[model samples]
Target: MKQREKKELDTSVQGIIIREMISHVTSEHMIGQKIKNGELRKKLVEPVWNVPDGFLLTEIKMEQFEMEWLEPESCTSDRVLLQLHGGGYVGAMRNAYRNFAVVYSELGHGMPVLSIDYRVAPENPYPAALEDAVCAYRWLLQKGYSGSQILVAGDSAGGGLVMALTMYLRDHHEELPAGLIAMSPWTDLTSSGESYQTNFEKDPLFGKTKDSLIYNREYVGLEDPKNPYISPLFGDFTDFPPMLIQVGSYEMLLSDSVEVAKKAKSQGVKVRLHVYEGMFHVFQMAMKLMPESRQAWKEAGRFISLFKDET
Candidate 1:
């Protein structure tokens, strides 16, 4: 029955189906079994090569910032989407998220996308990741970009980073962005969501396994896991810009996404939440294989298109 469903999903959203299956079989089950395992990181760091039109693709390195850029070809000036890739906070890189950026860059609004290569945990923890995200955003501002033309985006851990970054900037009185996008963000390191328990085995992508939880513990260390920066769902959302959050119905972080959106709404922040039925985490990348993923990507592209005139 699982194989039949996999085959059906493969016909629609192949990239997600293949990766999720591999992650479940290889990284998912093996997560907590061993003391030292780089398998999850290895699998998550796979290269992404697809590039879109209307942009120049390149890499940049500064003393304080290092990242890959996707600049639209026809637009002499454009807004920026500062993206952070997710891999349980210890894995994955900006390159791994290139395809998602491409979808937004060309298909969405032809805006430039700059995906940051933030430091991972164990080697660099807590504020290190937050600092990197801030530094990258500052770099763009220094390059003459306006806050009103910028958008912060991420998936899973990166999604959490975007929310934290917004809070940090607010606390520092820095100018806020025009908008934000969080795709199945892991807003809670504490994994207190009911969905975390309910969707454990039902979801093929991830669950509250002992091993993955260990990685979360290492990332949070002694800090209160519910700290707004660690879990932005707990933060003050006043004056936040218009935002969009997409979540998978089957994901453990489903509640996190919903709570964040609900909280944002209560604070009067314009928030749009799209709960994709039968989806797992970060399902947009699998558009190459799955129709659902393709539809999700198209939806993202459409949402981003609304901002093209803002820049």
Candidate 2:
């Protein structure tokens, strides 16, 4: 095993303020309420509905879900980013993701992005979201985009789905994308990582609950939590594309990114694991307001550049 190196970010005032805001608003009760109330969840994320200027969003109707194409006005690259939004398998794609998709395109060096509103749990459980993701990928392929011309990216549960999607493709002998970018990915549905304990008090969003399944039960249903499709942390990374995994030091899912990096490296996959000190979960979403978030997206752009010609 290679000696693990740490990449830390000195928390900025904006980062600290955002952390406190998240901590204040994201109580266990709120989480539970959001899970049970779809309208409430949608309202909670209403502040992030603003999509920056210089981007065009076109909604495409899929057989079972809606996929949005977010393209920069100056887009020149043929590469496409297949984005999966994070809401713990219960949240749908909202304006926040539409904004993030814009960032993905801008930071991904002008590559257009296709963001999906994959089916969520409680209404549509396992295989539903996975199936929707597969449909989006196939749509890209059918549009003449080769596998190598695409990069799959997501955050939180969506991050885990990125791996699950890749594994499904690999297992089924389908072409895989050129690379992956996951932000604070919830790769372990079983909540087996030590960070759940160590960072309990430190995690602002989900620290109060030791039971990770509080956010996962509806999705897992009766299925095994360790099932690779549900928890990619337990899956094989052999032959997987180069991946960039980013997580925060204060989030409970820190170990999800850490352990997955170890797992992927062990299987000979190229992986870059970045741990931002004093940051919270999925902080990259604040790229417009925080320096660290901007830095993270800059790193993503660098990573994407490496495979620009892989197609």
Candidate 3:
């Protein structure tokens, strides 16, 4: 971790971070190579980390990736939240993203969610993840949902992928989702942001030299890291969808979200960016007892609702 500026924190949030989370979600288990993809994935999707009640969870095999569905009993069967789980481009998505998937299902006015388990780094590298996501979108269309009925969303690297996938779709003249949700998105794989070093120690999730050097290389392989598909901060947002960008002020990727929102807004895309004070990377996942997390979800729900009438 790098040095960070002093932060003023919400007392309750501090307590939750120190008491409830620190024990298990250490840096080693998060951004480091020590991450146990299989074990940690299961732990995240545990029933204990659920959303509003009366939701059903099921795993399904998709055309290009495995996926888990989180459907509320009263969900809009035709509308879907297509989710990409973040793991620095190297994490498992199925069990890992299930908790947040359920939350999105409840908050998007009971919109069903399909969280894709895309191929990750070191093995499937580069365009593999994006390819799988694109396949998932096509699968949704095959099921009869129009483009306007879908919302593309992701957290961390998945958030970056949301931008990449949406751009790829538009470039290829494929149907586009109504909007996008990026939670602490890692838009800059180049690690060029000041916040990368500035917010390091303040962030409980990552390590600078190690994670940046290793995982980024693993994901990029021989590709140029600055390429938009790899580092979306460098991408143009001319035809981007309505976007809601959420980030923790304390996370190193804060600049990544800020820059993305700024660029998208400048391009006349509807953009809403919410920076939570003293929060960590993808803090939205801590919806269990965090008021801010709930508030973020509420904001996301509202954004998701904006496209409801179109569907």
What lDDT does each candidate get?
Answer: 0.75, 0.85, 0.77
Error of 3 at 163 (Å): 0.2
lDDT by residue (tens digit), candidate 3, 1-311? 32332235343555346433642455453433334232253245534545457887777886556877779876655678899888877777544477777767767767889888898877888999999999888989998888988899998889999999988888899998989999999888887887887876656555333444213567888899999988888988887888999997767788899988888888889999998876777777667567777788889888887876443
How does residue 257 of candidate 3 score in lDDT? 90
Which ten residues in a row are the worst by lDDT in model 1?
28-37
Q: For residues 149-249, could you state the per-residue lDDT of candidate 1 as single tens digits?
A: 88888988899999999999999999898888999998888778788788776555555454553235666767888888888888899999888899877
What are the per-model numbers of colliding residue pairs?
13, 0, 0
Better of 2 and 3 by lDDT: 2
* Superposed model 3: Cα runs more than 4 Å off: 1-53, 94-96, 207-209, 212-215, 309-311
RMSD of each: 4.2, 4.0, 4.3
**Which candidate number would show the highest lDDT if scored against the true structure?**
2
Give the per-residue Cα lDDT of candidate 2 at 70.
83
Q: Which regions of candidate 2 fall more than 4 Å away from where they truly are?
A: 1-9, 27-39, 42-52, 210-214, 309-311
Between which residue pairs do clashes occur in model 2?
A: none
Task: Kindly provide the TM-score of model 2 when superposed on the true structure, using C-alpha atoms.
Answer: 0.89
Taking all chains together, the TM-score of candidate 3 against the true structure is 0.85
TM-scores of all candidate predictions against the true structure: 0.85, 0.89, 0.85
For residue 187, model 2's alpha carbon misses the true position, in angstroms, by 0.9
